[model samples]
Target chain A: MSAEAERDAPAGVDGAAPADPWRRGRWPVVTILSVLLVATVAVSFAVGVTAYPPGTIVEVLLAHLTGRPSTVARVDDVTIWLVRMPRIVAAVLVGGALAAAGAAYQALFRNPMVSPDLLGASGGAGVGAALGILLSWGSAGVQLSAFALGLAAVLVTYTVGTLVGRGTESTLTLVLTGIVVSSLCSALISLTKYVADPDDKLPQITFWLLGGLETVTVRGLLPLLVPVLVGLVPLMVLRWRLNVLAFGDEEAASLGVNPRVVKAFVIVGATLMTAASVSAAGMVGWVGLVVPHAARMLVGPDARRAVPVSALLGAIFLLVVDDLVRTVLTTEVPLGILTALVGAPFFLFLLARGRRAWT
Target chain B: MGSIRVRIALATAGAVTAVLVAGCGQAPGSAPEAPESSSAATRVVTDVTGAQVTVPATITRIADAWPAHNEVVQMLGAGDAITATVLIEKTAPWLYVVDPALREAQTVFTNSTANTERLAQARPDVLFTDKSTQIAAKTTELGIPTVQLGFQNYPDLKKMVSTTADVLGPAAQQQAVAYNAYLDDTLGQVRGRTASLPADRRPSVLHVYSLNPLVVDGTGSIIDEWITAAGGRNAAQVTGNVRPVSAEQVAQWNPDVVILASSAFVAADTGAQTLDKLRADPFWSQLPAVRDNRAVINPTGGWHWDRYGIESALQLRWAGKTLHPELFGDVDMLAETRSFYDRFLHHPLTEAEARTMLAAQDPQ
Candidate 1:
């Protein structure tokens, strides 16, 4: 396919001609998104409750990078390094991981509407976090429990799917089982909230379910880095196979890829990434489902291009949204609410336009 | 295929059994009809919600649903009348330590919703709940006289105490007067000392309700009321109770004094550990309060003293002394706490027990 023709090709048509996987326009889209992400991060650094001028922000960054003591006010230095920097990094990591996992799942399932939480990772994480808050285990315990339960939820879904649909449609069984498990997890979360002390733990769980990056710190982000990177590297490396798996099971098997094995790998990678993101930032929605569609609209249906583009777009989108959350009002607005507010309308607009990203 | 079918059946059976076992804890049944009220004398008392509730002349068996108001009932010398309570032993250890009978009281409510069957089973003549019209109406339908009470300021607290006393009887009414006098005396004393202090001299106090989410009690909250009464300005510019703000926002506020609630970090420990953790954080360490060691945990008694509990009298004195030690140098919190417990709670606290309470620790 010619580069000019690929630019005009409907998104559904890009999936038909999979031979010309690498379009010439992919680099420019990636480059623009990369530039936008970098600019968003820089701008987020300067935006916070504590106003730091551009010069002061740069000085703090330089001092930290060079392993030298900062001469600016200690409060400003701490605010920039300890509070804002960690929050900015968390927003990027969570947003990128969620969007990348989302793209992988969408390609694996051959459904444009698939989100990272479609398999019940977020619901399970929410239950874990609620239990931690009810037990007064503090922030570390909440994050740990959320990560563990998220993985457990997906595992249960997979096990049930395999056991019940031995010779039937595998993906359909998995999706049905996922819906069952997600609702179960949600009910468990509600039960935890109901039993929590209304004066204390109830508000904590309520706020956590709404999702925010307010509590994220440098030390808190350290433990999550390993899982996020572990999950992202494999998805990026196996993007071409994910694209091939987008075809039906028979076609994918004929194309020299074991459909079931590839799908399993994609599920594991997507689950890890989604769980880590949910554990770090509580129950942030819409980015996973919406960002991948935007990415496909920009770079067509090839996972090799769409996954990376989705990561960049997700990071930029969440970074900007988190900046607004902290700076818009004196009190921090929940991150999940803002993402849905922004994502839902944009999604409706996309649907209204009839982009043919999916049949 | 046959073996898989068996496994699925077994799993389905297991799930159903688990759910059935959970449901067995609370039997599915409507509450038994409450007995008709005795032809005894009745008096009308208006609650905080402006509803005039006709309470029985003598309320012996009481179901106190509001956890904080349980302390108020105890303070009014009606501790024995409480037949059912929502005060968990873990949440309010001091209350249970003082009145062991509270441990035996049936818990008819979890969080805010009352189980009507359980409430009727408790057989309380009067049900004390917060300002939830739904709960009040539900209990009223069962023929239980539900008194809705809540407070957001010192005046409202005094009104709640008076209304609670109205339901208890004449003897408790005297205790209410005494308690209200003590509150006014303490408030007047604190205000008399700190009233003349200039704005610059008054410290900007940040009441840290929780550290992980960094929630602070802002203006329009009872904590804000006490902060002002104790001669400190609320550092949080927002207006609400337990509003979560960013750490950077707190750093910007740069409060002169950071008061940690007893349950700030965890449910169990005194907030000293939470204070230590805050001082260790790079963000908090840079704050003026942490650097100067001005951060202190608010002492919790029957309830958090800084909250809307009856201990606001003690909180006023404590805050005044903490904020302006020079002005209130002669005050001894241990002696005041001992006297308060003896006079109000009817529990003669030893010196060590008083110290533990002042330190915001559970009684051993």
Candidate 2:
């Protein structure tokens, strides 16, 4: 860690301050995040099928990987391998990706209000998902189109923001464009709902909007995991650049960081992560906005420390919420509803504590 | 600083006071005096959205907004109380079977909310509805009490009969008991009729409609229970209630009896042509049920997802008998329909009207 710090930190640039308690370091954060990632994955697989136990989950997973069939009950096998296992994996990856993206957005725009959802990805994804239902697209096709449409929405937001005057898009301008784009997408979704068959199509669209992992198969999870990893890995590598960002753009530029290039990279990477997650999970809200704030309260506002913590916290938060849905109720509550119900009140409490933190 | 503390104290006190005031309504008051024993009149209670109401020991005037509820009201010997009802033509074409005189007495309500005021002017003692709907809520909030009843399942139907009877007084209790007995007997008959058939011989059924890609009944649903009782298998037992199954999966399952219920599709063309298209499809035609010509078309009238009363039970019997004529015996279902109308509907039907009603069902 010291060797890497000496390589990266300029000589005489280290100024230890009374206000900043500890110097931000990269290796420590990476070590913590790696530990958290493993723990979350383990927890995800551990949560389902109490009868079989966690050891049995490891064994079942190994057996499946090795092509050795077991005499397990088909329901147990299906629930563990087909249903619960994929969903658990999906939740962990998606949650981590969304959290990382949210942190990146906050740093890039130099505003905590900026998150992946600020670009209308979720809304556009919703419209695409509705269209899939309307056209009677198969499950695989539906998921694919949803992801594509989400990326398309962000692309439009980026293009519109950059095109107006300057090459760099201001935070306010990006937000306003997102709102407009989101409204247009929402209107299209409503139009689809208006003409949809009331019995079958309406329920499908409603359930999709509510956002649960019930329908996610291994096939759906695999393609989504690829983009999430691609987006997430780069964000983690460059996560140190985000800490300098909290010093404001002018200060960061003075510190020998190229603010424009860094901001663009982080924004695009974060948007990609959010789009991929939204497409697969179907508009799970509150995770991006609330998770980082939660991490800040837990570990304080150093991005080097906060980002990894937020990602871990986000993964744990979703995993527990998903478990509650599976066990707490006879009917599965939508993940979107569960997140909002829990997160919204907590957000209000945070706002009460320090309203300035919201901006 | 003292003022700030005082203000905070006041706010806390105000919240506490508000909570205490709200909590004060928890205690119950004393019961009202019981009515006279010698009156021989039935006491009817109503819950409607609006229109002033008066509870009486006997129902002198009734306003039936929902036609399915009107059938039960008629069956409970409260036909005289019914001053008006909505959807008479669509609900009980068989109403003429019981009392031909009810057809011409009065046209009390239309399908619009404007009719609420008109019905209020006519002055009804009770309003009847089948289950609570948005319209029922509006009418009840407007001070009109409705006796909501529907038979979507046996429990809901039993509750409807019992609740309606409780408010309809002594005469209704007798009718309720009789109706309950009739339902038991019919269910028993169905069980007995299907007992001898082999499990494999039981027909696999599918309910198709335009509203969804694929819709099927839940295993525990009344539709599944009735289908099983009739020696027919519901294809949806594998999935849960009205779930969206892929079209390819439906083709693979290939149910023996395809029952289409969407009014939207029914209005498209002759029901026969629609059935023919399904039959002609290579995947659909490959099913064993389709080759045997076992597709049965359900008639229009009292076709609802939630209403499972005596009328709905009869409809199930009609489907069973039509699908399995050899097992149920060669009975005229129209005659059965006529008797159901006569017993439960306030209006009498002519033979011509009965034919017209049945003909409207669209195998044509």
Candidate 3:
């Protein structure tokens, strides 16, 4: 590591760091986004399994919400409330959680590419889901096992990470531990997959590995949503502290921020969000990795602007991808495949042209 | 920074709008109106997924996403129409001789994913598959009509044959009707002979699908259906199509009849002990089925009876004959099997060939 360069001492002691990069237009963007998120979700309910008209979907959803009896066709009501509604809700929750957590990790690790799964939540959840399939436990068991183990994997990583370092190297050490744990979980998943029955169990395992929101149900979403909200609330509250955390620990403390305590809270929040997202919808990669980059590109490096926008952007991106998935073919393509296909090109484009937004 | 951020957001908005338009442009357009009658040159069959898919009323050229469905189509007498197939040579090499026309059919798929472009070049009137979402999607994208074949049980297999026969048009209808009648007659013979047996008199059968992990066929599986038809209760009490249990659990089940139904490759790759390979192991001789000399290998022709294939109806006979040899003592299985090939499959088997086809013992 290079020694710290001598810097010009603050001339006025508090000159606000040269007006901070083009004054992020956060709320205007967010307020517009909040409306977009609602509209996108409302639109998603009309177009899955079978397409219903928008007016009919709106009527059915409103009726279901108000406890007013639905007069729409049985298929329309069932499609909207029973299947598509829960699925879109899952997409929103998972998408929002991944983006929010991704922003947190990018801030905490001070690495732009740090995804929510940097801590091995996806890997652990995969192994758990595979084990559930092997045991012939039903879908509930699979989701529960995945959720439980995903949280466990990260907690173990965090606990193990703190052991290897006391102060200066803690954050980097934690990332290293996460990579190691994720690799371990991935290897275990491979082992389980190897022994699984190729005819039946293997296909189920392969499907889960590919990751999707196609299997989301109302029952499955309830348990996942609570933890995801709980995880996200803390991150949204601590998002401002992310800017302080971005300056290495010594600098953070000098500026009256306890880096370790704040880092722990942020990691826990991110972990919870990631674990919940993964447990709800298997291993959907790239959303956490790339959505934040796009968000950061749009709103500079300030966590207060970027994190919430990341959440909104992630939700919109997933909704559109989900739309493409349901409509593109007769069957649901794994969202992971679509995201990677979409994310990689967008990433290169961001690198090529959006470098200024990162400042 | 401000200007670039606006461009980034605008670019994103533009891309999203482009995708939405392109995506909506392909919204299944309008589902093809299914023809009213089979005589209308296109017959609409509601597939297992409950989607009404139109198939050619006169199926002259066919292709399947997987070779497993090739055997089913062949049995339904539509094998002549197959212009392309997947892995038929390596998998069921017998198909090349049985249906010499298969030699000319292109290999359009080997594993799960089909080469959609090559498949389209094959110019099949209809695509046959045993139901796959990926295949279904690809066929729809390529505007190829597809028929999804499914067999829930022995009874469902009959229905599948009849349905496929109807789809294949008039020429195959005779074979479908004849096969259905044969199915009824064969099962009727088994039921007539075994219907009088008390519940306790019927043997407890265990279908060992794999031996290392000790995976067994449970309820909802085709093996379970065959066992039930053959007049034995499945010993492994479980739910789902199949379940992987322990050797310890196998011992506890104390199955009177253990039928092995795994291949050498599966056994080797999974490091699972096949019934044939377990002769030297200490645990092999300890089981109740082994003690009674009731351990037997499942018969395979084209493919195993357990898999959804044409040989499944014959599997019923084999299961019944093996379980209760006393009742079916007069039925010459070898001669009857040869006749089945000669009459239904249109390929007569010599004595040596029939014996090879009937062989269940591990050559290993």
Question: Of the candidates shown, which would achieve the greatest DockQ relative to the real structure?
Answer: 3
Error of 2 at A195 (Å): 2.0
In the range A110-195, model 2's lDDT, one tens digit per residue, is 67766678788887788888898778675666677788888788889878977753766766677788888899899999888866
Error of 3 at A21 (Å): 17
In candidate 2 the C-alpha lDDT for residue A38 amounts to: 54
Candidate 1, residues B239-284, lDDT tens digits: the string is 7777778998998998999998876866454567767777788988
Tens digits of per-residue lDDT, candidate 1, A1-359, equal 12233234334443453333345342355554555666677778776655668898877665655444456754455456555766777788889889989999998888887899988999989988888877766467788999999999999999998988985548989988999999999999988865554554575687678787766645566555568767876787788898778778889899999888877777888889889888888899999999898777666677877887788678777888888876765335678999999999988876876465554
Instruction: Enumerate the candidates' DockQ scores in order.
Output: 0.02, 0.01, 0.05
State model 1's lDDT: 0.77
Model 2 chain B lDDT-worst window of ten: B25-34
Per-residue lDDT of A217 in model 2:
49
Of the candidates numbered 2 and 3, which has the greater DockQ value? 3
Instruction: Estimate the lDDT of model 2.
Output: 0.61
Docking class of 1: incorrect
Q: Which of candidates 1 and 2 reaches a greater lDDT?
A: 1
When only chain A is evaluated, what TM-score does every model earn?
0.92, 0.86, 0.91
Ranked candidates, highest TM-score first:
3, 1, 2
Alpha-carbon deviation at A8 in model 1, angstroms: 17
Judge the docking of candidate 2 as incorrect, acceptable, medium or high.
incorrect
